[model samples]
Target: MKILHTSDWHLGATFEGIGREEDHKFFLNWLIPFLKEQEIVVLIIAGDLFDQTQPSAEAQRIYYQFLLSVSQKTDVKKVIIVGGNHDSPTRLDAPAELLKLLDVFIVGGISVDGKDFSRYLCSLKNEQNAVELVVAAVPFIHEYRLGVRTSMHNESEIHSLFKEKIQNFYFDLADAAEQIAQDAPIIATGHMACRGSELDDAPQEIHMIGTMGGLPSAIFDSRYSYIALGHIHRAYRVDQSNAYYSGSPIPLSIKESNYPRYVQLISYEKGSKAKTVQKIEVPVLRKILEVKSNLEQIHSILLNISWQTPMPPILAISVQVNSYHSGLDLELKNILKNKFQDASPIIAYIRQIPAKSDNNVLASKEAFSLKELTPEQVFLKMCDTYNEIVDENLLQAFRSLLNEENI
Candidate 1:
């Protein structure tokens, strides 16, 4: 059977502050047509359908509309929606029965040990092939739901407890798969990380924390036909066909700059030993571009970039300017406004300059200038400035009063 594997839609997400409603709409518009053309039967949205646990009303309406549209437009038999860290399981799974009537299966917020999960072996006839598959759907496991106590001291201890609890769930899932699939094939689906072939760019110094990390590959055995994973935002395979993460539908962060956002079309044909696999890329609305250059070069680069296309609302625009550019601070803002305009979706514009010479001078051409700070730092500084301007005298008086009391 032909299945479209996609995840991390992060609907209602904005690039910086710019809205992604258009991007989401564009995806839905193209997706319906694509599914029809491909003659896809199952569409597996692995997880993070929404960017936040509590989505906005408009986001909810649009999300439901997209689901309904797909159900109406395609010959799709099942749309499996799992839960990721960003989704509230209760919220996504609320209208389960109603959605089932529409042929959409919302499987978010599932617990590993929870009874009455409604997961099982199912069969469908596609061209009389009698596609038999057992589904073991696992949602993003929150520690609180799993009954794992956490008065732990450090990352390692916390991770240890998490692993122990989650592994039991995996074993239970395996047992279920073995029992249900019988001679039929089994496919495991989860919104958790499973040590995919790609390495996360997260620092080595860091330890697995809460839902941010994933289980190792060893935990996922070959008993199942394949394992479909989500959470990580890049399309990657753990080994080859056995396990894979269908990255986010749109580029969510600047770190995902190089990876092309896509969905995978997986076709499974039963083999003597293993299931034959085919992976095809389903193109999305936005293409992420990363350009590095100085202010002068950037001006030229922006002009060269075609903003007319539906660029991703989430942009990580980085600018590397000379530290001593007298007008760079002011020019950068003007350039972003003029070139990007209000229509452009530039979420962040990062400016980095070479470290200044320790020799401080008013006009040494390389003096420490503008007091280098991050965007967050800049905001804090502005707040500090406003506070000083408004309450400087009052703060001094309070300090003096405290000093007198101490004396």
Candidate 2:
């Protein structure tokens, strides 16, 4: 049987308050037919279904509409959706019972008690209604949910505790999955960032090998034949393991424009232990481009874009200038938007940067005032100045406090 894995839909995503619903709509429109063509028995959305904790009503409509299409238009047996850091557990779980009636399983958060891990075991059956596969729907397991309960100032201590808790959480879930089904290949879903994405703790440790240089493949139990992961916006196989990140369907940020997004198709032949994975490229409905050049060359650089984008692109331009000039952004917007009259580019961002440093300022080191620094950055700088041995934990704690205070 074949299963399709995808994640980080971020439906209602926006850049500088500019709505991103069009791109998502294009993707969803394509996905419905794609699922039917692939004849995928199960569909897994690892996490981050929405871009915001409290998504807009339109965003919610897009989500439910897509699910409705999959239910009525496709022959998919099961639809599994887990939550990411941006998801509000209550919001995702509110209509859980109703979604299940459509064979769409939503797991926003694992129970805090951890006793209901077995409830997360979603069984996927074949046409004959015989159990063929099982999925361990593990969502974003925040450190606070574990023993930490809340963020504290001790960085090293908190990090160590968090790692141990994570390992134990998976171990227990593995135990629970095993008890339910032995012969069925146990596939697991997760929404954690790779070690490379969280490199603040050990910046020196570069992943020259598997899982994009961060997550230990061993963290996942061996029983899981295929581990579908989300949170990292690029599709890659975890080194030394069976885990794979299917990545975001559309480029969410300018830096991600070059990333070729894809959804994964994993197949396991009947009574065969081997699993084969196929990467299906997602169609680019709206293009995005970034231009970093001086003001004199900005227009030429944009004009020289060679990509035959499916649609007129969204542009993020960083213009280097010798000095500040008023109305420069507007001037460029008016000039560039007319370049493609048939499908004009949307100027999403425009920033003017100094082409050269101030003549009087020292070039030895860059300097910025406190106003330019976030409170956490200032705290870290103070720690460094005092020779205090601090780590990411302290920084996280500071941010947690700031979040609580709504700073």
Index of the highest-lDDT prediction? 2
Residue 304 deviation, candidate 2, in Å? 3.3
**lDDT, each prediction:** 0.62, 0.76
Clashes of 2: 5
- Estimate, for each residue in 116-213, the C-alpha lDDT of model 2 and write its tens digit: 78658898766687668889999876666665633443444554565677777787888888776668788999877555453331111111111134
Q: List the residue pairs that clash in candidate 2.
A: 155-393, 195-214, 210-239, 211-238, 211-239
Shift in Å, residue 285, candidate 2: 1.8
Minimal lDDT window, size 10, model 1? 201-210
lDDT of 2: 0.76
Stretches of candidate 2 off by over 4 Å are 127-129, 149-154, 196-214, 358-407
Clashing pairs in 1: 15-314, 197-238
Give the Å error, residue 399, model 2: 4.7
